[model samples]
Target: MDNKTVLQFQSLSSLVDPTFWYSLTKEKIDNIKLSDVPLDIYGYYSYNSLQSSKSNDNIKVPSFLQLNSNSLTNEIIPSFSFPMKGLLKNTNTIEDFQKLDKKGLFEKVSKKIWDSILNGEAIKCPSLLNQFLLISFSDLKKYKYYYWFAFPALLLENPIYLTNTQLLSDYLNKNELQSLHENYQKLLEIPDNIKKGIPGYFLLKKDDNNHVKVGTLSEWEMFKSDDKNKTIVGFADPCVLPNNPGWLIRNLIVLLKKKWNVSKVTILCYREIAGEYADLSQCKLMDIEISGEELSDNLPKSVGWEKNIKGQFGPRLANLGPTMDPNKLIESAV
Candidate 1:
């Protein structure tokens, strides 16, 4: 295929980088090599592993987190599961790292990635933002923009899901929503009103072809499957914070809202924060029982689960969804 055809293909579809796409076709974008590209272009690259795997075999697009064991190889996606406390010792930026770390369980798994960047072993850690910085870190110092900046900003956002079930079953009662917010402020000392604009329902869409798609409560409409009878629902544990998988959730939500016209979205989270303290004030909070089966099917939004070229730095297998070349988004913006 010529460069134009490749470029055209990238524009019409979801891809992270044309080079990465080319690498995939040439068998370069497999499990473990890093691409030298800008982070913004590849920000959502491989948001889900299952989604990546399906993109190779199936012609259709899959959700970033829809993981089908049948379609994916058994190789586990490498990642470190670090505690919040341990990360503090290695890095000075605690809050920023906490927000960017998501799951707070990566230090050990991403050690190679971290060590590679620190020791200059490889290009950079295999993350969207970090990859770009690692590639251009020396010459780009004048820009004063590093991936670390996003870490703290996104962390300061403090976005989280508060399950209704958790509220009712766990600690907070309906009446306690307000007080809990106050308590959360006192405990975390994250400040008040900083948690605004957080949404409640994390909508996940999967097609009959076994492809998992993700979205926020709003994006639920773009992924309404051909089966008109299907009910769109929340896919993962509502309590989880914004990791790559959660980023998939955020992307799905953001994309759905942009592409589709829908109304009345809600979510069920597994934790209880003050209503004022919770990130999603717009959502109608409810306590519902999310089924285990639904969660399992909806989880891995894509087929390739962390088995792609970039090592453990990208989203987990559960996060990758259909994406276009990163060049498409970043180059155009420039």
Candidate 2:
């Protein structure tokens, strides 16, 4: 198994040297031995284990009456994930880092992560991390900029399931359901009001029982059978800007066509964005509908978007649907 290692700085001053962070590459990172990485203070604790420990400790003693008070108050040193070696293939310079620091980009990124944690959106592996290198030229005309790299820690995973039938059933009462449906319609009427856009794709497949099962790309990667029988459902949040959804769908279609035998392609999006992509690709378009029940399963256990109340559930459903054979979709379309 490939070792997954992350880099840590003992102090912020270490960042003063631009080469310190930017020079790291996949080769260098992969060459890193387990001994090179700092040991986690609490050892490796899975999400459930950490929660159980906290519960047990709380039950055993009162907060003010703990025997090891210092342990509870000790500050956890802040650390960021190092970019995976090959992931950011761009060559960068030290001057780039210096300029970014001067521009306060580091502080801005730090604060963004801090604010997220404060709002209860815990960072998690691969999800919280940006796999790309952000290069900012110092001057566009002069062609100068800095290379800034941030590797968020592989935090405990937070799993979110859109298909939590109980949770969905309890949360969406008749009135709430109607309001949700109405809100979806309103967005279709006036998409300008949707400021925050979500990017995701869907797949529709039939299980052995022939019951339709809806899933996301990530889920399909895990559960898809070798046989070709699937449909690709392209979706974008209504609030997403017009150009982005079309671009995303086009990219998805190209990617799916290359990897699988996709049959028919269908897009569920706002009318305006749907129209834009309909001409670009040979696919079907459907009205956007928001339903908690339809999208109750095969969702990431936890996502960064859930940090906001508005992003909790409704938006997720509209973006996810049943799984289908990608090859069949492409073949059928062709």
Candidate 3:
């Protein structure tokens, strides 16, 4: 592809399950009190999205990233989802939330990503490339939550270009596809991966013997081969579109370019279609050229603060008073 042939990706959409707010409510009333410190939270994107034309589901464009009751807990993340780490900054009052430096907060989170890439940490655990932020104010009395989400992405000085795209089936034979499925399943079976969560980003290695294996980001050095076909970087893609991959691909290209000095790569947009199993038929294979231009001052500009419901740059409000307030529930029952 020429320099003029740029790439476009589908941004990830957040889905905060109701149980998540209930869990936060309990945590706040019981532990947080008047504190405004940020808390570590986790979220995951489901592979079985409804956006695909082949899907039998009713909804369109179902959420890519989701937060549930257990997202803030110290327990195991469930299967069939690719995990991502994030921060939850909950203020004690709405006034405090309103006063926050939104752009500064965005830059802070993005800087962490940039630092990780520079320090070579992101090469070991690529999920750091997908770091996100959430800011909120829980109205205890009114039972309303004012919140916003930001999925930070590094801007490339010279953008990546897509030269080719195809389905996994078209790229690999049936045997190779089976090997990939079995290997990736083993990756999900690792004990620690089950406990915390596995990185959505991973390595797919097909050796000279044509033996395919699944590996983590840390294995990239050892996994690399003279023949480009030997290593394939794959991500558990949440985007259901045929052409556009998910938002996280943006930072991955930058990390690959900056840290490893790789100007081009083949990416597998892995997907699980229809049910709780990996489906190669739904996956997309992409060959792209990453412009390895050095970003000025090593601090790339970022984007991805979620747009409000009105399609403007702002936060959203979730009112739970009628449904969540105990007093209201009791009054309705009486």
lDDT by residue for model 2 (1-334), tens: 1232221111000011222222222223454322222111110000000112334533211011001111112222111111111112222334433343322432343334334333322112111112112322222122232333332221212211111111212323444434433433343242222111111234434344323344445454643444654333534322222222222233233233323433234343322212212211112233211122222112112111111124331111111011123444566677
lDDT of 3 by residue, 40-95 (tens): 89887766555444464444453367888988973545567756788889998778
- Candidates arranged by TM-score, highest first: 3, 2, 1
User: How far off is residue 323 in model 1, in Å?
Assistant: 36
Residue pairs with colliding backbones in model 3 are none
Candidate maximizing lDDT: 3
List the lowest-lDDT window of 10 residues for candidate 1.
4-13
Q: Is candidate 1 or candidate 2 better by lDDT?
A: 2
Error of 3 at 309 (Å): 1.3
Global lDDT of each candidate: 0.25, 0.26, 0.78
Roughly what TM-score does model 2 have, to 2 decimal places?
0.24
Candidate 1 lDDT over 1-334, as tens digits, reads: 1111100001111222233323322321253234332222222222111212334533223222211121122122211110010111112133332444333322232332234323432211112112111111111112111121111101111122322322222332343444433432342232111111112223333333333344433343464545442334442222233211222223223222222322223332323222223432211223222212211111122111122235333421211122333544565667
Off by over 4 Å in 1: 1-76, 79-232, 235-248, 268-334
Query: In candidate 2, where is summed lDDT lowest over 10 consecutive residues?
Result: 40-49
